[model samples]
Target: MWYFLMSDAFTFGAFLISYGTIRFSVNHWADPNQVFNAFPFAGHANLPLAFVSLMTFILIFSSVTMVLAVHEGHKMNRKGVEKYMILTIIGGLAFLGCQAWEWTHMITGDHTVLVDGVLQTMGTTVTNNPWGVAADPGAITAALQKTPDANLAAIVHSLGHGGTADAHATLGRDQMISTIQAANLHVTTPGPIAFGGYFFGITGFHGFHVFSGVVINVIMYLKTKFGHFDQRGHYEMIEKAGLYWHFVDLVWVFVFLCFYLV
Candidate 1:
């Protein structure tokens, strides 16, 4: 297990270091604040670090529950172990749900902006961004012109412009940029795609770890249900799982700092 952990650590370390190198090497990268300011049901409102912070809280609290389970294990308190383990599993699942929502929001690129009276959806691709310097005002306007008024108006209202789709359907280029920035949706002209790539890779890797930890915890819970741990005369399995869960939670702190807070 130690060897496996060391190998995995090396892998994550390499990925993170590479990300940092490329991110800093670039002249302009997307700001974490602008990139991750959306929250669930907030509709692109500026809730900087709020959702991720909640996720961090959930994982950290799960780590605490895991520790308590381990403590119960040391005491050979089967019921206590089972209870805390269940709590830990729930926390893990919640975190996964949050990640799913975040990924969906990112990929769907449903963010809309009025570019010359045309409502255009903002999205990210492997090589381009509709919200960055590469954004073509003409194309955006043309696309939005085809978009449904209901869709365009919803976005405009969300930005607090108070105009219905028909009332304020189009915006000048400068006004569009200003509206996006004012809503904390700022992006640079030459945004780095590498930043998005690395962000997804590292976070996805860490998320996989969390998922595995949850699976392991569930298996251990089932085993405990069957009296496996009590019959074994030790709950060392719980401790082992605890170590992995804690490591996962710890790694997320760094990931959060690098990809979100930084």
Candidate 2:
């Protein structure tokens, strides 16, 4: 297992290093703060890094619980092992739920804006997001110029200060959609498509590890409940599962830093 983890480490490290190289080489990379600002039930309030911080804490705390479970297993305490393992499973599930919501938001995007008292709809293609380099007026204006018409120009005029002028502007998702549409343009993905490809691939791989750890924990919890460990006169299965769980948690710390915080 250790050897497997070492190999996995190299795989993820290669992806992250590639992401870093591409990010610095590009004219624009999406700001992590702007991209991950949304929070549940916050009504679109900008709460950058808060939710991911919570996710990180949950995973780390579950690692703590996993340690406790292992310690209890050393004492052959079935109840303690079951309890901590269950907590660890809950933590894993919560993290998965958070990831699901995040992916949904990212893919669907913020694509509706009220324009002149009318709500408008826009969508994200593989090539667009306000968080990208599209916040440059010159780029959007130049793009619009290629398809010049009175209507597109009017859209550009409305998007004037809101679209590209304020690079760090926290416009509503809907308003951003409107601006992108009016500009008749698509912003490049943060840095290059490779950045996103690595970001999603590495994170998704970690998430899968978390999910598998949860399943292993659940089975161990059930075994404890059914007296399987008691018959064997040992709870070492819990300890083994705990090692994997801790590994998942440790990997997440690196992931959060590379993909979210940094």
Q: In candidate 2, where is summed lDDT lowest over 10 consecutive residues?
A: 114-123
Q: In order, what lDDT does every prediction score?
A: 0.77, 0.70
* 87-200 per-residue lDDT for model 1 (tens digits): 999999999999998877777664554444455555554554444444455565455446564555555555655655455446643444445445643222435667657767
- The TM-score between candidate 1 and the true structure equals 0.78
TM, every model: 0.78, 0.74
Using lDDT as the measure, the top candidate is 1
Question: What value does the lDDT take at residue 138 in candidate 1?
Answer: 57
For model 2, how does the per-residue alpha-carbon lDDT over 15-123 read when each residue is reduced to its tens digit? 7787788778877776788678879877657899998999999999889988998888889888888888888888999999998888777766643222222332232
Q: Which ten-residue region of model 1 has the weakest summed lDDT?
A: 181-190
